[model samples]
Target: MPLPRLARGASGRPAAAPRVRLPREIKVLLAAAFVIALGYGLVAPVLPQFAASFDVGVAAASVIVSVFAFTRLIFAPTSGSLTARLGERKVYVSGVLIVALSTGACAFAQNYWQLLLYRGLGGIGSTMFTVSAMALLVRLAPPDGRGRVSSAYAGTFLMGGILGPVAGGLLAGWGLRVPFLVYAAALVVAAAVVAVMLREPRNAAGGDGTAASPPMTVREALADGTYRASLVSAFANGWATFGVRMSLIPLFAGAVLLAGPSTAGLALAVFAVGNAAALTFSGRLADTLGRKPMVITGLVVTGLALGAVGFTDNVPLFVVLSVVAGFGSGLLNPSQQAAVADVVGNERNGGKVLATFQMATDAGAILGPVLAGALADRLSYGWAFAATGAILLVSALVWLAFGRETLIREPQLQQRPDGTA
Candidate 1:
């Protein structure tokens, strides 16, 4: 669907806000994202166990997980350059197929090293599709509806993350390798869907319609204060959300709270519940109230709630804090993404810019657990959580002090000659 045009008032200003409608391309991308995330979740729970089955020790098995991320970090820039040269549609399809091949290979691996190599190869493909997808969104998403589009996209991934594990666990009853094959099959379907359905934006092409505009460089993006703030926030988000949440939360629940595995699972689920609830409306708020406010609010709420998680001994309080922190995360993500989209705009490819932004987050996810784990070991869980919260709070302060709002209001949207906004 095309975005609704702003109706004018007697004074020639936009009379009221138009309803947000997503375009067909974004919908297709969302479907693809769901399939990709679900396939990923299918493997996540079983990967370590699968690695251990090859006679590797615990740390070695764990390395299987880390290698994927490490490769993604290193390969991101190459992915960005590929997207710029090949176009998002081509790169996206190829990336999905690469992952499919690697994942399928994982199912037949004869030893730990083979599995490691295949999994590491998947990371290269992972960044290829990831960078391309973000670029496509920047090109295709309507200016007025970027936040809502981002929210919907994120929601699909969350839903898939929730459902994939249950299905994978059931499939695991067949064999550890079954899930890998299933995931590979799912990726193939996703790739087919995108290759068949998604199309590049007309504006992305030159006057001859033979080529795309030059990609926005990392140097250009870095010149913007908002983009810089985005990197900082992205890092903090990775540190707290991806790194600490996955690694430390489970450990803390088990060791510090004296909670069972079930409780830790419940805490994670509650966080998802809270995140889903916020996603329902946060996008619209970001569009209307502005991205900067939502980001700052999310940071404060997440920082305070997540920071408090370690200080409390009560499991109930811990669960409550977890939910609150998730809500804050939901609030922050769409706005942060929309702000970055604003910086990139829709005029040119943001491949390198988006890749750099992704790298910061990936770096945080990689480093946060290591450093935070040390604090947890030498100090205490309280100190670790406190430090995590402090990081978020510090980012919030940065935004409050220097970040600019990136939402383009209805009145501000420029109309093209073709009548599209």
Candidate 2:
């Protein structure tokens, strides 16, 4: 007799249907993200300049930027709690709606403080959606495919990131405020699609066959060494990728490399291209080899690349190095996300844990720019870039010392006695 075919799932239940493609819910989530991201991208190029339109000084205008992170930091715990109570679907949709409203309101703000308030409100919504989306993705995906699934999710954001600024620039030609209204509309459309298309997975919705393990607590998750390493890595990822890249790279291109705006733009585009390309393969590598090795390799490569970018004055070389650094980041991200999902491990109430992980990144993004910019002003661009590299290196060291491989292969558990797992 021939052996029976089996399906993969949390309870090892045989699938009723063959899953030749990614799950429908996952596709829906990615679609929603792409649309939302597109709108977000549309607004990114104009936000800072819009804030300055109120006749505020540069420092005051910058407050508009910082307040978003500050609000996200403060609301993270609450966002997690809501996710646990309301479930990811409700929370995700509601959060998107809130963000849409707030972002639209920003277009009408007549003064600097008004813009700041609206932007801050949007931050809270942003956190709500971000944490809930992560919680949903982790819960829905099978353990074996976590890395690839995360890469897909990340890819949607990259698509949005790539297209948004370009679209935003074109919309700016119409009016500075036009993009905000369009972004708000795009967000609404995204929320509606998610509402229509997304149904919670059977496992996550407490279906008939399997009872889930008790959800892990924030305190418990924090005590785990792997989780701690994730936090460290998350912090560094945010610092280097989000914080330093945006705030300092342009200045380095302009002042240090003696490059023009076009060169700076090209450098950013190159980095994004590298990042997108790596996302395609890195996730599969993480699934096959393991999360720890990929993450460590990415960190080391990124650190060395950043350090090298600092010492060189050649613009072309700088662009090349930035692309290399971005590729390293691409390798690191999916693995890091997969590792956290491993620790989360079928828990229902992972919102708080995910929130905490996200908070670490937000905190790094919030702090990195101010500190790095101060260093660049006082010392030099080279020193600032080098210091950022050092932080990433330290984060990698932390992971090396404390992190462990987290991919849980199902076959290993099946090999144990009684088939009772």
Candidate 3:
């Protein structure tokens, strides 16, 4: 597929600027991402409640949630190796089918142990597809359009995430197991779409069109300062966004603000709204301006806003800060992913490199809550929020000091015969 091109003026002259037009394969990936995220969201809101229904205590029920992330972290290396060996399309399809089977099994679980086992198995599949998907994006995205592609992809998942929970709540009226069945069906549909529509890129060949470049290794990738800095920022992002936001925000809303469940849900919804607003333009800025500036700016904005969140007693102020924090995250994500793509380039497979980066994020998500919760218990919620904010700020400092901009300027980008830049 062709990358984006400059539109022509009325007189057939090239326009002064180029516009990003996503290639067909990326659109396919985006479609599959939406389905996958929507299905996952359907399961997420109800998973704890479903586990509790098995006559388990709160701690045990929460463990069901933790185990999935734990398994994803543990199995990531293996997933990377599989993606490298079998290719992304194969791993992606196989991974989706495995998750589908596991989710369907969850619907039929007769006991807590069964549910736990099924959910844990789903994590293995999650890492498999997640790693392959990143590798595929690295391969397929047009060089100049990587940020825009990442943004569109993230936006689709965000839209699905915003819609899925509401739908899951309605489906729960029917039964908890119904959502699992529905999620399983959604996974099957996503797998079918990708399996049918997405074609794997042929191996990068030499002038003779016979030999392919070797896959990029993690060791080689680590030599780049940008990748190393990205790991720090990725960890901070996982810590603040996935871990603390989900775990701490609701508690703060209920305990500190003395708000109802609806209020807490509203805060989350507003964050998503702010995130959507930023996605509208941040990607284009990243593509046109630079990745480093976006990353640093996002981290600073998120840190400052989130750090102040615990100091505020007013509900309106809390909600506004949440929105600001979400906006910062939206600005950060696409540029971060695009920078990684730049490092990997289009010619070489980077499954292991991508997996290692993913592992850093997963590790932060796994550890952040446990540590922050302890701080909340011993110190205060303020300390927990501040600590998370501090981590983000420190990461921004790392980027400022050491990170390199990875966006390839037009003059520097070289297009191959295959039309890749």
lDDT of 2 by residue, 1-421 (tens): 2222333456664322322257788899999889888898998889989998889888887788788889999999999988877788899999999999999999999888889999999999999999999998998877778888899999999999889998999999999999999999999998999889897543454665677445567998887778999999899888888898878888888898788888888878988988898999888777766788889988888888886777887887898898999899999999999999988876466888999999999988988888988989999888888988998899899989888888745343343486675
Query: Each model's number of backbone clashes?
Result: 0, 0, 0
Worst 10 residues of 3 by lDDT: 1-10
TM-score per candidate, in order?
A: 0.93, 0.90, 0.93
Candidate 2 vs candidate 3: the TM-score winner is: 3
Estimate the overall C-alpha local distance difference test score of candidate 2.
0.86
| Model 3 TM-score relative to the real fold | 0.93
Question: For residues 182-275, what per-residue lDDT tens digits would candidate 3 score against the true structure?
Answer: 9999999999999999988656673467887788899999988889999999999999888988889999999999998887888888889988
- Overall local distance difference test of candidate 3: 0.89
lDDT of 1: 0.89
**Candidate 3 total steric clashes:** 0
Residue-by-residue lDDT tens digits, candidate 1, 313-403 = 9898999999999999999999999999989999898888999999999999999999999999999999988999999999999988777
- Sorted by lDDT, highest first, which candidate order results? 3, 1, 2
Q: What lDDT score goes with residue 145 in model 1? A: 80
Off by over 4 Å in 3: 1-17, 206-208, 412-421
